[model samples]
Target chain A: MMVTLNDARRVIAAAETKAQEIGQPSNIAVVDAGGNLVAFARMDKAWMGSIDIAINKAFTARAFDISTEKLGELSQPGGQFFGILASNHGRVMIFAGGVPLRKGDEIVGAIGVSGGMKDQDIALAEAGARAF
Target chain B: MMVTLNDARRVIAAAETKAQEIGQPSNIAVVDAGGNLVAFARMDKAWMGSIDIAINKAFTARAFDISTEKLGELSQPGGQFFGILASNHGRVMIFAGGVPLRKGDEIVGAIGVSGGMKDQDIALAEAGARAF
Candidate 1:
């Protein structure tokens, strides 16, 4: 089954709560298994630039079936997965704050958060994923 | 004033019902005022390639604050807005299946439908926009 609207809302709500707790306004995006957006929210005071970044992060996580932080590590200089950033119309976001939503062993969707420090974004993303 | 998750889901639900009535599986996309995806749905058996088309249609409608069919007419050869497809990285979808979602005089978002004939897509898109 695909990621339903209910699942997307749950993830967004959790992410919003986490971002509020961190005192960092954020842009949150959720995408289905096909890397298509399911839900998105731009919190008050969030960076407009982070809107695309958040969506791309979710798309990248769903496309690769891996956390973006892990992708970033593998995409570092001299790494095996390097240069993948140039692919997919340069939409592969190799950064923190993106994680797959698992149903059993299957990745049903992904959530991405932006407009904060890497660690803060990761925290909000993790909160969102945990809600799923 | 933004199109919330509730609004997007309601629109998608209405669009899905209309597509079902027409016996056509469809890909639906909803985007906020910033022309960023807020939600999307791909009905079972919908054409995978139509996913991007659905999204671009919504983005185009939101970006220009006009129905895609009107834009299509205006963009025809020798028309006032001809050759506009070469712009926006070819993401501008001038077709008959995209309409803006309005809140009073404000254009809050847009909905797009694809994976069917032009008329069917337009019907579903109109159904979605009316749900808002």
Candidate 2:
């Protein structure tokens, strides 16, 4: 099954809560199995430029079925996935804060967060993914 | 007000139901005010190529704040937007099935439907936009 409206809203709420606890405004995005966006939220005072980054993070996660951090490692210098970021019309994100949401064993969707440090973004994203 | 995840999902669901009633599996896409994808659904057996078409349609609608059908009319030979099809990296769609979602007097987002005839696509897309 897909990530319904209920699930996406729950994840966005969870992410927002985490961002609030951390005192950092954030942009959150959710995309389906096909890497299509389902929902997004830009918190008050969040970095406007990070909105696209958050969306791309979620798309990258769903496109590759891997977290952005893991993709970063794989895309390091001389790594197999190096230069892969140029694909998909330059929409691939290789930083952090993107995670696939699973239903049992199948990947149903993904969550991405931005407008904070890498670790901070991942923390919020992880919290959101848990709501899936 | 932005089209939240809840809003996008409701639109998609409405579009899906309309497509089902017409016996046509469709690819549906929703984009936020900035023309970024918010959610997408590709019904089982929907035409794969239509996925991108649906997405571009939504983007185009949001970009111009006009229905694709209207855009198409204006894009005919000797019309004002005749050459607009080659703009935005060729992502513009000039056809039916794309409509802006409005909140009060504001254009909040847009919905696009593909995988059916132009009339069917427009009908489903209209049903979706009304959900916003």
Candidate 3:
């Protein structure tokens, strides 16, 4: 029915296994349906900066219900809802690496991970989701 | 035991599905451990403003271990940690929606989702997390 606590745990487990498989340390984070923190983790060699980035990605995906990539395209000049985020608030990063958690058309929550290249981060996150 | 990249993906998927089920057309966001933007999606008819706010929420969550609401509480004039975030950085929002990812005691990252009211924002984020 939702991205329950049990689901969150499953996501983390899968992500960890993927990170290890890739031979790269990582930091992963999870948020509730409302983007509230549910859990977190950081591997030994993960960059300190990656931790924050990972969390933001998860939140962004959950809040927007779309990939951060879309945000970038929309941010371009003449696009919709541009620069409004700056006026409304700060903390909007237009990169990539975060993904969402779902259950048959229902929004549950989201996850974010960092510690390697952008592609690696994305791969790991996707891997974690697939595992779940 | 901690949040992982896989965990990040699952969270977003759940959040997306929840928004759809609610019929609320929402904006969701996710971030990586470094607070970088990752995945984001805006429902077919979601508001333009709520989208960016969602991403920022995610970034804030990843950047701060505590919730954005907690960050707001700590932003007091003489709190243990004052406006240091201002001096240290420029884009840090303190509000709800953003939350951390964790595995046991570990912190992987976090997530943030918007669209819908503040309570709604939090509600959906939680739902997505649970679903995943």
Q: Please give the lDDT score at residue B128 for candidate 2.
A: 97
For candidate 2, write residues A3-63 as lDDT tens digits: 7656877898899899989999888988878787666677755776887899899999999
Lowest summed lDDT window (length 10), candidate 3 chain B: B81-90
* Greater-TM-score candidate between 1 and 2: 1
Tell me the lDDT of model 1 at B118.
92
Ranking by lDDT: 1, 2, 3
DockQ of each: 0.27, 0.17, 0.06
Point out the higher-scoring one by DockQ: 1 or 3: 1
**TM-score of model number 3, chain B:** 0.76
In model 2, what is the error at residue A29, expressed in angstroms? 4.7
- The alpha-carbon deviation from the true structure for residue A68 of candidate 1, after best TM-score superposition, in angstroms, is 1.1
lDDT of 3 by residue, B1-132 (tens): 244456666888888777777677777776767777667777775755476667777777777676665665565456665453463244565545667766567555667776664566676777655643
What local distance difference test score does each model get? 0.89, 0.87, 0.67
Between candidates 1 and 2, the one scoring higher on DockQ is 1
The Cα RMSD of model 1 versus the native structure comes to 3.3
Candidate 2 yields a Cα-based lDDT of: 0.87
Order of models, best DockQ first = 1, 2, 3
CAPRI class assigned to model 2: incorrect
